[model samples]
Target: MTFAIGIFDLFTYTISGSIYLAFLGYLVVRLHWVDIGALAGTPVPTLIVFVLLSYLLGYVAYPVGAVVNRVVPRRRERHPRQEFLRRVPTAQDRDYVQADPFLLLSALQLHDKDAAAEVTRLRASGLMLRNCAPPLALGFVAAIVELFLSRTPAMAAGCAVLLAVGFFSLIVQARRLSHWARMKTLELCFWLPDIDERYRVDRNAGGGSSPNNE
Candidate 1:
């Protein structure tokens, strides 16, 4: 059961991460490198394959990473739990599975809720906003306008209108990211282990024997 759930949880995490990476690429590539219009002419099947590849990469990246960990050994990791939370390359994340079989699944859901709430908080503060909203909404409206842009048509207007709207979302999302980053930092700080001998227990664990026994 843990194996099945871990696989599924890891896949979801990977896909989300992959999409994040792809979206980052889209922003840079569309802005400076590739012309979206030119790319649109590519064969549909190939495009579909490319998207599937993105999702597939996301789905397997973590599990493959975990499996790799099991298959290899290395210098012992310091702060392995933090490393796991950071989602970097690790030999395995079986530690979490071992700690609590349902932990991975719980983390996924909790992370989502925590992320959304953090974003909303930032939005209220005018720091971060959803970046794609404007462009997407404008594009939708443009499609309608373009059907009649010659009359009331906005064939290309959607893209331009959306560009402006999307900026607002970018601000909100930025704030959200910053807010969440701060929270994550705090959480890590809270969970960080302390090994100072000075802090070790000074009390006897009843090793002297109870007074009654004495």
Candidate 2:
């Protein structure tokens, strides 16, 4: 599971990084900083270099993802714990009300491995979507610049519109996936008898700690 998660992380980073690199490439070409025509002659070497740089750029773009998350704000609705408590009357009596939803989810994972895996997968996908938004936004800006620079303004304008739609869709889907993952976690805990029993016992025994109080 850990290895799989790591691979997913790499895949997400590579995709987002590639888009970011493309954005940079567009800017470079527009500015006449590098002649891509010459680079195209050595296609093999260029592809190899691009692949390597994309992976490296993936790491660099991670902080950009963090900034995107902050700007987008995951908690657009009530916190997951609050939502869970509202939905499940029994949960209101437990430490889950005050406990961080993420921590509580982690604790629930100890008792429900399969459901935990699904939650992990959902969150990973959401993260990828979130990270990709910035690069797409950059690409949209590049397209707008292209509109001004290119002889065919219509083509560039079309590309910009497509990118703009893609950027908006990615943000919307990312938020939905994140919310789904959280709600799924709470739902799984409520439905699974053994997991619910274990979680309730743990919280009642003072195993769960509230983040605010800490």
Candidate 3:
């Protein structure tokens, strides 16, 4: 599962990085920094160079993802844990209110392999969508620039519009996937004997519902 998650992350990075690289490549060609004709003639070597550069840019693109994340409106400004507590009923119990949802979920995963796998899958996909947003935004900008530079303004305009729509949609889907993963974690925790016992103890000690501290 860990390896699978790492591969998914790599794939996300590569995809986003490729877009960033393409944007840079366009600028380089436009500025005459590299000869496009020469690159085309040495296709194999150029492809190898691009492949290596994409992986390197993949690592660099994380900062862009961080910037994009800040620009995007999330459920809460603080940790997602706070949002989970506010939204998830199971997280409202006294025991869970003060507990870290991620930690609890990790503990739950130890005893349930299937639940662990599912959560991992959701998280990986959410991360991919989230990371992709940055490059898509950059692609939109690149397309707009291309509109001014290209002879076919209509095609460039259409590409820009599609990139704009895709960027927005990825942001929405990323948040949804993250929320779904947290909800699934809480739902699965409901069946865990240890979690049940914790709830039982909290109810017995508190004798009522706990107020949301946030």
Full-model lDDT for every candidate: 0.39, 0.72, 0.69
- Candidate with better lDDT, 2 vs 3: 2
Model 2: residues with Cα > 4 Å off, grouped in runs? 1-7, 28-52, 72-79, 85-90, 191-214
Compared with the true structure, what per-residue lDDT tens digits does model 3 show for residues 46-104?
77667667767877776666567668776553344566567765556635444445655
lDDT of 2 by residue, 1-214 (tens): 1212264565567667787888888778878899979776776767767776877787788778767666764445536677777778787665344545577577668777777888887877877787888988887887788799889999989998998888778877877788788778777766645554565577788776554210
TM-score of 3: 0.68
Candidate 1 residue 130 C-alpha distance from true site, Å: 8.0
Task: Summarize candidate 1's per-residue lDDT along 1-214 as a digit string, tens digits.
Answer: 1212232233334344344446555656635776667766789777665656655554444343333323433334234245445664342432231232122223433445554444334333322123223234434454455556445445455555665456445534444454443334333333223311212221223211111100
> Where is the poorest 10-residue window by lDDT in model 1?
205-214
Clashing pairs in 3: none
Q: Judged by TM-score, which candidate is best?
A: 2
Q: Which candidate, 2 or 3, has the higher TM-score?
A: 2
What is the descending lDDT order? 2, 3, 1
Query: Model 1 misses residue 211 by how many Å?
Result: 56
Which portions of model 1 miss their true places by more than 4 Å?
1-50, 53-151, 154-163, 195-214
